[model samples]
Target chain A: MATNITYHPSPVTPTVRSSLRRQQGLTIWLTGLSASGKSTIAVALEQALLRKPYNLSAYRLDGDNIRFGLNKDLGFSPKDREENIRRIAEVAKLFADSCTIAITSFISPYRADRDLARQLHHAERPGGEPGVPFVEIWIDVPVEVAEKRDPKGLYKKAREGKIPEFTGISAPYEEPLKPEIHIRSDQTSVEDSVKIIVGYLEEKGYLSAPPEVNEV
Target chain B: MATNITYHPSPVTPTVRSSLRRQQGLTIWLTGLSASGKSTIAVALEQALLRKPYNLSAYRLDGDNIRFGLNKDLGFSPKDREENIRRIAEVAKLFADSCTIAITSFISPYRADRDLARQLHHAERPGGEPGVPFVEIWIDVPVEVAEKRDPKGLYKKAREGKIPEFTGISAPYEEPLKPEIHIRSDQTSVEDSVKIIVGYLEEKGYLSAPPEVNEV
Candidate 1:
C-alpha cells in the first residue's frame, strides 16, 4: 500500500544563536483601529529599537500586503476575522521563539481571540523546547478619531457600502481590556510615540547604552 | 441597533513613524523538519540580524506552541497539514505587512503545502502589496539520522504506532523540489549551516558588512 505521505526532520539548538544576539526574543502585538496609528507607531518603534544592540524584526499585516496572498480567499466575516488574527498570532509566536523581536499590528477586535494569542505564546515547546513570550499592546485610538483619519479612505468606503464588514465603522473593534502598553495616537505625535515605546523597551532591558559604533 | 463596532476617522495623514520603519522591514522565514535544526538556525539568524542596523523580528512555530493551540483540535492528517501550513503562511504575510522578519519552522514536506506558503506570501493588499519574498530553505538531514536525533522522540513513538501520523520513518518525506537553500545536518556542521544561511542573506543583501562593537 503506497500511502502518499511525507516527512521532514525538526530543528533544535537556537540557544547559541540567541546568545549571540544579546536580547531576549518576544512578540509585540499591536491591536487597534485601522488609522489608530498602529502601523505608524509600530514602524517608529522599530526604528527606535534599531539604534540599540538588539535585533528587532517588525512585521505589520495591513491591507496592502495581506489582502492578496494568505488571506486572498478570506472574506470579511466575523469567523474570518478570528481566523485571520489566530493565524497571525501563531506566526508571531514562531518569531518569538527565534529570539527576534516579532511585532504585529491588527485590528484584532475580539478579546477571546487576543487572549487566544496570549495563551498560545505561553505554551511550552514540545520535547522541552522553550516557549516564546507574547506581548499584547493595545494601540488605543478612539473610534471617532480613527474614522476621521482613515488614511486610505477606508471609513468612507465602509459608510458608502463599497466595503462590507469594514472594521471600526461597519465592523467592530474591541478595545483591549488590558495590554502591555496602550498608545493613544491622537494625543501623541509619532516621534513622541516612538520615544514612549523606546522608553518602555529601555526599561524592559531591550535596549543598551549607545554603542561606540566606530568598529565594524 | 447598536452593533458594538469601533469606528475611526478617514483620510489620516501618513506619518514618519510609518515611512521610516518601512525602509528597515524584511522577512526571515526558517523552514526545516522536526529536530533537524530549523528553529536553532532561525534563532541564530535572528541574533545575527539583530546586531545589524535593521529592524528584524523572528517567529518560530513548531510542535509545542501551534499543536496546543489554534491547531489543537487538528491532527496530522493531510488536510490538517495543509490547513496548518496555510494558516501559518497567512499569519506570516500579516507579519510581513508590518515590515518585520517573520521566521517560521515546520516540516512543510509536500511541495504543494510549501507552494501554498509561497502563494500566501504573494497575496497583496487591495491594490496588491508588493509580493513578500518567499524564501524556502530545506534543512536537510537523513530520516534515519533525524530519528536517531529525535529530540522530541516523535519518530520513535510514530514507529511504534503511539502516534498515528508522523513525518519520516513511517510517513513520507518529500524533498523540496526547489528549496532556496539546503542545509544538510548529516554532512555539514552547525557552524557551516549558519555560514551557508548567513551567506545567503548577505548574497540577498539582507545582511550588511560586519561592524566593530565597543561595549562600555
Candidate 2:
C-alpha cells in the first residue's frame, strides 16, 4: 500500500561520497595463484601508495580475512569459485567507488571470470573518474615452486581427498593470456618485484612518486 | 609459461585505514517500497542519528541513484531482480562495514530477497559489530491509498506498458509475514510516521534517546 507520503528525509548524496573517495585514489587489484607472492606484492604496492604525499586508501580482499568472513559460505567448487569472484568483484567495485587502492589478491584462475570483473568496473559508479583499477596481475609461478613453498599444504591436501577441486593440482588452472603485468615468483627477488610493480603504478600515474621508504 | 621468481615484499595491513574510518561510527539501513514513507522517516532518522554523541555517517540508497548506476545493466526480470537485491545487499554490507548508517529505499517485492538481505547482517566483521540489523519495518498502506497518491505517477505508468512489470501494479508485492515494525502510511501523518520509526529505532537500541527532531 502507498500514500502521497512524499517526504525528503536524509541528505547524504551518492555523488558526495564517491567524490570524496575519488579525490583520494584508485583501486589496484592483484590476482594470482596461491603462494605466488600476490599478498606480498600487494602489500608492497600499498606501502608504496601510502608513502606518497596524496592520501591513498588501500584494501585487500584476500583469503585470510575475506574468506574467513564475507566469503565464508563458498566452497571450492567451480560454480562456487565463479560466485566467489563475482561477489569479490562487486565488493572491489564498492571500494573503487569510495576512491581507494582496492588491492584484491585471489587465485582467480579463469580468464572469463576475471574479464567479467573488468567489465563491471566501468558500469556502477557516480560517473567521474574510474572507480577501481581492475588490474590483472598474473603472478606466474610454476606448480612445483608453489608446491615447494606450500605454506598451507593445500596442494598436498588436494592430492589427498582432504580438499576438492583445488587449482593447479586436482583442477586445471587457466593462465592469463594478456595480464596487465606478469610477475614470475621464482626468478624475481622480492625487492625487484615490488620495484617493478611500483614502477608500473608510477608509469600508470597511480603513484605520485616512488615510495619514500622502500622495503628490502 | 610459468617460472620460479622470489619476491620479498612487505605486508601492508588495512588496520590503520579501517581504524580511521571506524573512529567515525556505524550506519542504519531502512528498506521498503516507493511511497512507503521511507525517505520521509529516513530524513528525520538522520537528524536523530546526527543529534546523538556518536560520530555519524548516513546515506540513502534510493531508486534514482541505483537505476542510474549499480543496477543499470539489470532488467526487471526475476533473475535480474535477484541479482539487483544481491548487489545492493553487498553494498549495504560494505556501508555497515565502514560503520555508517546506510538507509536504502526500494520497492523490494519479495520475502526471499528480504530474508537473504537479513542473512547478510548476521555476517560477522573483524573487530566491529555485525553489519545488518535483523529488524525489518513494513510500511503497510492499502493498494487503493497508494494508487490514489501516485506521487511519481508510477502506478499509472505501470498500469500502462510504460514501466513493465511494476511491483504492486502488474507484478507481485508479497507481504511480510512478520515484520519488526509496521507503520500505516494512510492513517498516520508524516510527523507521526517519523515518530513511529524513530520510536522503533530507540526500542531497537539504534537511537540513544527520543528524537528531538520531527518532520512535518
Candidate 3:
C-alpha cells in the first residue's frame, strides 16, 4: 500500500492537450552509427516539418546538443551511456506529453538501450493507457561510408585508437532488427530521407488536421 | 584534434523556435514543503495560463507524476534526490527550448541543486547566448501548517518514522535565498495563488500575446 504512489494530473488528457496545441505528439527516434548522418537528417526533417502548413511544431533533441546539457554529467562509459539514453527517452516522453513533436537523434548503439527507449514511450503515462507514438528510424550506412563522410574526423580518431569505446570501432554498435524506417544516409539525400519519414508520419495519420487552425 | 567532436544543427536558435512556435518559453519552478499545495497551485496556474490569449502552451511537471516515469529509477536518498532534481531541471530546459511554458512542482529541499538548475537554464545553449527565463516561485508554508494539512498523509508517515529522509521532517529544507515570486500557500487559496503567479508572468513580459484560443 505504501509503495503504491498514484499520479493525479489535471483533467487535461493528451487528446485535450493535442487539440489545444493543434498538433499530435510523436517521438521520432533516430538511431545509427556515428557520422552516419543521423543529426543531419534530423535537422532536415525538422525544417521540413516546420515548413508544413499544419498546426505542428517539431522539437529536435540532438545527441550532441543533449550531451552538453541533460547528459552533461554522463560519460562515454557503458553504464553512463545507458543512463544517458534512458534520460533522453524520459525527456522525449515529457516533450510528447506537451503535444510537441519530439525529434531525437542519437547513436544509441545498443539494441537493449534502444528497445528500452521504445518501451518507455509505449507505456509512459501513469496508468499506461494511451502510449505515445514512437517512430524509430535507422540511418543505415556502412562503416566505410560513415568514415569517409566523417566531418568531425571521429572515424579516423576512433580507428587510430584515440577515442576509446567509440561506436563501430571499440564499442559495439548493435543495429536495429526492424526499424520503422530504414535508409542509407550515404545513398539517400537528406531531403529524400526527410521526405520518406514525413510520408510515414502522414501515412500514419499524424497529419490528420487542418492548417494552422485553433478549436475552442 | 581527434578529441574534438562537432555538433551541426540547424541555424535556428531558441528565439526562432519560440517565434515559430508563437510563444515565449518560461520555467516557473514551484518549491515548497510536502502537502504545502504546490501541485494544487501549479494546476490552477496551468488552467489560468490555458485561458490566456497567447499561443503559449503551459505544461505541468508534477513531482508525483514525474516520479512514476522519468525519476522512477531514483529514490529518496540525498544523492538520488539531487540527481532527481537535476534530471527534472534538464527536462524543463528541453520543454522550454520547445517554446512551452514549463510549470514544475517539487520540494527541492537543496539550495545548491536549485541553484545548479538555475545556472543550467541561464547557460543552456551551446553558444551560451540568451538563456531561457527561469522564475523560481517559493510556495512558502510553515512546517506546522503543512503537517496539519497533510493531504497524502505523508507528514503523518514521516512523523511516525515510517518514511525517513522526509523534507521538513527528518530531512532539512534549505529555503531559497531570494526567489522571484514568494507566496504563502497555507494562507492563500489555490486560485489566488495561481492569480498571483499569472500576474507575475504578465508583469515579467511573458504574456506577450492575446488571450485563450484553442486551435483545431
Candidate 4:
C-alpha cells in the first residue's frame, strides 16, 4: 500500500480526458523479428501524424529508445522480457489515458504477451464493449530477409555466437494469428506502411474531428 | 539480447520535441506524509496549467492510479517501494520526453529513492550539463495534522496495528533536505500552493513564451 496515499475522487474519466485532447488515446503496437522495419515505419508515422490537422501528439516508444532508459535494468531473459513488455504496455496505457497516440516498436515474439497487452488496452468503459484502440501491426518479414537486411550486423553476431538467445536465430519468434494490421515489411515501403496506418487511424475516428464553430 | 538491435540515430531532440508542444517537459515530484494534500494540490495545479495559453498538457500519476496498472505486481516492501518509484520516474521521464507536464503524487518517504529519481531525470544532455527539469515539491505536513485530516481511515488502521510499516506511524518518513518547492500543506491554501508552483514555472521558462510576429 502507498504510505501516505489518500484516496481522492477520480478526477476526469478517460472519456473526459479524451474529449479534452479532442482525440482518442491509441496504441499502435508494432511487433516482428528484429530488423523488420518496425522502427523505421514508426518514425515516419510520427512525422505524418504531426503534419495532420489533429490535436494528436504522436510519441514512439521503440525497443532501442526504451532499452537505454526505462528498461535499462532489465536483461534479455524470458522473465525479464515479459516484464519489459508489461512495463511498456503500462506506459503506453498511461499515454493513452492522456489521449496521446503511442507507437511501440518491439520484437515481442510472444502470442500470449501480445494478447495480454490487447486486453489491457481494450478494457471497456461503463457501457462500452471496447475501451482504447490497440492496433497490433505485425511487421511480417522472413528470417532470411531480416538477416539479409540486418542494419547492425546483430544477425551476424548471433551466428558467430557473440550474442545468445537472439530471436529468430536462437530463440523462437511467435507470429500473430489475428493481428489488427499485417504489414509485409519486406515487400512494403516504409512510406506505404505509414500510409496504411495513418489511413486506418483516420477511418476509425481516432484522429480528432474538426473544431465546431461555437457549438456551445 | 535484443535481436538485431542497432544504434539508430535519434529522430528528435528534447528541444525540438518541446518546441512542438510549446512547453517544457517538466516533472513535479510531490513527496510528503500520507494525507498531506499532495494529490489535491497536484489536481488543482494541473487544472490551472490547462487554463493557461501555453500548450502544456498536464498529466498526473498518483499512487492509486498507478498501483493497479503499472505497479500492480509490486508490494509495499522496502525493495518493492524502490522499484515502484524507479518505474514511476521512468514513465514520468517518458512523458517529459514528450514535453508534457507530468505531476507525480506519491508518498515517497525515502530520501534515497527520491534521490535516485532526481538522478534519473537529471542525466546530462549532449553538450549540456543537465537535461530535463525535475521540480521536487515537498508537501510538508505534521503527522498530527495529517492524521486529523485523514479522509480515509488509514491513520486509524495504522494506529490499531491493522497496517504494518506505515510511514509516520511504524516506518520513518525521510524528509528531503533541499527541494525545489516546499509547501507547508498544513498552513497554505491549495490555491496558493498552485500559484507558487505556476509562478516558479514562469520564472524558470517551463511555460511557453509569447508568440512571435514573423518567425518561421
Per DockQ, the best of the predicted structures is 4
Name the lDDT of candidate 4. 0.81
- Model 4 TM-score, all chains together: 0.92
Give per-residue CA lDDT, model 1, range B56-164, as digits (tens). Answer: 4444444545555546546678887887778777666655554455667777777887887887676553332356667788888877788888876777778888876
Instruction: Write down the worst ten-residue block by lDDT for model 1 chain A.
Output: A1-10
Model 3, A36-89: lDDT tens per residue? 888888887886776546546788987565877667877888998898899888
Judged by DockQ cut-offs, the docking class of candidate 1 is incorrect
Superposed model 4: Cα runs more than 4 Å off: A1-7, A52-55, A125-130, A210-216, B1-6, B52-55, B126-130, B209-216
The positional error of residue B8 in candidate 2, measured at the CA in angstroms, is: 19
Error of 2 at B97 (Å): 2.3
* Local error of candidate 2 at residue A9 (angstroms): 18
Clashing pairs in 4: A4-B34
Q: Model 1, A38-127: lDDT tens per residue?
A: 777766666555433443433344444344444555566888777777766766676565555667767788899999988878876644
Q: Score the docking of each candidate (DockQ).
A: 0.17, 0.09, 0.39, 0.44
**What does DockQ come to for candidate 1?**
0.17
Each model's lDDT: 0.63, 0.62, 0.80, 0.81
Please report how far candidate 4 places residue B14 from its true position, in Å: 1.7
